[model samples]
Target chain A: MAESRRPLPRPTPETQHFWDGTRERELRLQRCDACSQVYFPPRPFCPACASRKVSVFAASGRGTLYSYVINHRAPPGSGFEPPYSIAVVELDEGPRMMTNIVGVPQTPEALQLDMPVEAVYEDFTDQITLPFFRPLEAS
Target chain B: MRPGSVAIVGAAETTELGRIPDQSQLQLHADAALNTLADAGLTPADVDGVATAGESPTGVAHYLGITPTWVDGTAVGGCSFMLHVRHAAAAINEGFCKTVLITHGESGRSRIGRGGFSRPAASLQGQFEAPFGTMGAPSTFTIPVLRYMKKYGVTEEQLAMVAVVQREWAARNPRASYRDPIDVDDVLSSDMIAYPFRKLMCCLVTDGGGALILTSAERARDFPQRPVYVIGTGESVETPMVSQMEDFTTSRAFRVSGRAAFEEAGIAHGDVDHLMIYDAFAHLPLYGLEDLGFVGRGEAADFVEERNTAEGGKLPLNTNGGGLSYMHSGMYGMYALQESVRQLRGTAPAQVKDARISIAHGVGGMFAASGTIVLSNEAR
Candidate 1:
């Protein structure tokens, strides 16, 4: 069996705008026009208030390392190398997203919880650009 | 909704467990279902309601040649079986069905006629979490423990203790996989799969299944085996993605589900004689302990380290060795419920003497959903 390439995101009608922003190196999020509450993994309606009145806007792309695990075993066909860090970053706008930590050693000593980090985009394909995080000081 | 209205008269696991290559996923369900029916001294024709996960209740009913009046195919995650039990009980009381058969089977290791665990690119997980190289449970389900450790001053040794103590229970069970005794040192020194989770802290991936039969309390006494009354039940969900959990230190779903069960049962924490908190990973029991109000915040680590949940301790937990030392087919909630039934029936390998009440609590996804069931030997 041959090694399979890593999976890429497929944008839906509701989430296409967020993926579109990523291709241009911008972090896009949805906020409710009625409640002014921000959310992620975009949808047409506000999850908080069930209000369909929402708008898309560019985000700061800044966050802090909330939690993560240094994976020692890579799944078959997943392009990740062993000992890579899979982290969840708490965005400044209050929604949290899962991403990878880059530009630093993927070890407990290097990736501290609550450490300030910023988004860096990787263009995997013409249609998909994944956003990873790294120590703010490293950038 | 009322305590003791419904009771479990039949409970059994597959004829064989741990690496069953001969049985496909549906066959495993059939094997367990047949075993359970035999345990209750009934036949497939007697079952009027069907509930299951992994395999559809429709498929189970058709394969077993039963024409069911009511069925539930709830597949939230590992804990789906717990929800099935709750739903089955309510369905029975409402006259929707008489005898309910809930079954679970998964060829997790053999991959025999089993579906792949992939999400569509357009799905929520595929769009956000999976794109970043998230592997299955080991990578994703094990993500929140780091924040939990930092917030509560939990140490790696304490986490290892969960595996160690459960192994003690497994050692006494003849059917447990990898029943040889293991200690905290052995656990800590074991291979690391994910940070904060060593090889022993992770659940074993084996192929097995279990089944249960429930009916109204009035009809339960006619069965051959001791009837375990369904005293209370609860179920809830939080988020599908681990990153979206309200707080990493706790499981909001577990809290909500457990409280509802306890309230419905009208029992205090002290009334529980045995407990089974789904241990898909080591951190789960820690979160379960606090979230279920068995311990205060930041106290579960010390509570387990102090031997409160170990053998001859205040609360006997995971007495069947749990998913860690016991058998963990992808969905482990069935096995958890089985152990609760065994403990309450006084037939468990590591049975607590004179055990009366047992609570089986399970988390479905990565803290995404939860279901809790309280069982007792006495009707009251």
Candidate 2:
């Protein structure tokens, strides 16, 4: 397979655990011990209470498609093909994440808002795994 | 202090509007500043305060030979200049400085000596928004439009009317980059950049700059040109990422900023003779109208479709064709302010007949930040 030229995420001291969880096919979020607030884009302190007493916990990878746009133009030097879907997936955990909707045609007709979705780990590099979302199949 | 306490005494754009390959970004700022200073019949030494964005305020001051006592470099986004005008007013009121000069220049199309702003891979947008292949403003900004359309039943035709009406205004502007007449069909037929947003719906990419000089209302008449009084100003910020916007249907920043400005100005919505909403995309005006309380929720798109914002409408918007049809040099708030000043001065090429009160509202990032300036020819 041609090496994916998509930009990869770099783990920082504050975001290492989140990436490590992604590497293990899990979506991790931080919950505040004081305010009981859950947040994404992990940080050491709770944005609500400014409390550092927070813990990272795995979340249910299931989410719903809040909104999205089908990009017809790929940015200059971006390796991704045109007509890819960029989406905002609202996790059942009450936080929204920016991700790509995969396993479906990148068309508005095919992509419906409020559709149930589940996270899929996409590896841009061997050491990096990013979470993408796809429509959950009916049982 | 009340907002009308300050006034804009001078305003000018770079000598040329579109595509100037010869000048660097800094040179564009200097060109605009020199033109504005000349319009006000003042030299750089007369400026006691300076503010700018996309470039350093210190650099602008040094280049313009302005040893300002107060300086602000609030690089919020396109709306940075609006916030600067507000901040300059506050500083002037508090006696921090007088005769403030706010400038903006961007070689967006030419990319000459433009600074880079690549976020660290671990940054919020980088780790969250960027990894999803969200491209430039065009792609990322589409997320809200899609949701807004679905919720409000705003048709593609209603959205296209924004560009169509703005182009009508641009046709009358000699300096507008694209003066050719276009309709909803033309906008719809244009190349699809992102789903629902065509090439015509997006703002032009051009190399240009604009500057404004503001002072207290007491010293306004000393300038060469008729001063445009700043009656009201407001600013607020949301999330930097478009996807993370609190509500895709409306911009919270626009509401907060617009409401504050309206309250401060003490002007009824109907009293606004002219309006300028920074239209980076066609949907922006819809959001601005609804959020600013000009029209009720979900009514802006239809209001626009009915020609409520066109040339002879109840409110004339984007008199300089806005960013959509006019020159958008990255930070577009300055250009919008320039139009407001022109309308109030009775000197705009496509002048609104007897236009007195003009509102210039701007969005910084992808609904991330906003600033509103309510201006009038008459001082309260």
Candidate 3:
């Protein structure tokens, strides 16, 4: 049996910069020039203030685990093993992003809520590099 | 809209509750719609408005041979039916259309003529969340519960108790898919699908559908069945992504929608005799109970643990076994609404005694949207 390919993010013009940063091994996020509100999952404008004067910059790459679930059932063709951690990490700059927690046991005892984590990049293809997180100490 | 100005004269689910591979998704919608119309002693010619969620209103209307003056295709997820009811009422009050028929059907389990649940690679979820190995509702919807539990001191046993009590109700309902008695241990020991969520904690993936017919309250007396007045209705949306929810512990959409419905009804929380919170997962009711103002924040787990939502309690919730034990087609809002109508009409299988007021609340996506409806046995 052939290994199923995992789904990859298809970036749009608005989100191209964030993906570009990931390829260069940097976590990028957007900040609003009007309200000074930092946001994630990159958008062209500030979600809070609706200001189009948003700027993208390399983020701190540090965050705390906000919430998560240890998924035992992987979607067919997702190329993930069972019992992986699917997590939402709240970044230091104040936005949550969904990412997998790497370099630790995927257990409730190990993945405590509010534990500090930092970003680590994995090059999936020449054009795509995914940003995952690890325990802050491990990173 | 004025309270009791609109009433549900016809409501019915497909004759068969589960596993209907023979029927296409649209056929299931037609089945439920035809059954509902028959219940009211009417036909397609009587309906001038059409509303549906899973399927386009135009398709449902044309398939049923009804020339509708008003059509609504609110595809907000499971709770789309509840919003349809609310919008249809407003449309009726404004004379946009007269008689409205709302339909819902999904071949959730069989996947018979059902659209794929895939997001476009460029879609927000595809770009931001899906690439992170999230399987489906089990992986995503169950994420916030741990945070909720940590903040509220809610134990896993209390969460399991939700499934247990709903099963107790299911035991009384012959139509429920799983009627056997289950305890907290049974739920906790069930196969783990996602961390902190077991198979029993998740809703059933069954194939079923339901429909409702709404008309002016003045003509409600002419119907064969007792009229379940649509006293109040409300709907709201929050975020598309579960990770971006305003707060992880509570659902803003549930709060906004529930409060609007209660205010419109001009009723107190104590007046509610029956309740049906969309139980896509066990944690949903916990959030619904708190967010809907039935219980204080962080109080729902304790409320369920004390059997307050069980039989012979102050409140009767999920009387039709809920989505947990009852048939949960992908879109479960219509079933929740159907159960509310049944309770208000004194026809539910696990009927609450003299249940005068029933509230049916539903959630769409992963707390992305919500719709709430307040029903009364009396027009006033």
CA lDDT scores, all candidates in order: 0.93, 0.90, 0.92
Task: Name the runs in model 2 displaced over 4 angstroms.
Answer: A75-77
- Lowest summed-lDDT stretch of 10 residues in model 3 chain B? B127-136
* Model 1 ranges with Cα > 4 A deviation: A1-4, A75-77
Rank candidates by lDDT, best first.
1, 3, 2
**What does TM-score give for chain A of every model?**
0.95, 0.93, 0.94
Residue-wise lDDT of candidate 1 within A5-87, one digit each (tens)? Answer: 77777898998998999899999999999999999879999999999999999999999999999999986656888889989
> Whole-model lDDT for model 1 versus the true structure?
0.93
Per-residue lDDT tens digits for candidate 2, residues B1-380, read: 47689999999999998898999999999999999999999899999999999889999999989998999999889999999999999999999999999998899999898986686777788878887788888888778887888899999988899999999999999999999999889999999988878899999999999999999999998877998999999999998888778788999999999999999999999999999999999999999999999999999998988898998999899988988998898889999999999999999999999998999999998899999999999978
lDDT of 3 by residue, A79-120 (tens): 898899999999999999999999999999999999999999
Model number with the top lDDT: 1
lDDT at B8 for candidate 3? Answer: 95
TM accuracy, model 2: 0.97
Write model 3 residue lDDT over B169-283, tens digit each, in one string: 9999999999999999999999999989999999999998899999989989899999999898899999989999979999999999999999999999999999999999999
Give the CA lDDT, 0 to 100, for residue B355 in model 1: 93
lDDT of 1 by residue, B18-114 (tens): 9999889999999999999999999999999999999888899999999999999999999999999999989999999999999998999998989
Where does candidate 3 stray beyond 4 Å? Answer: A1-4
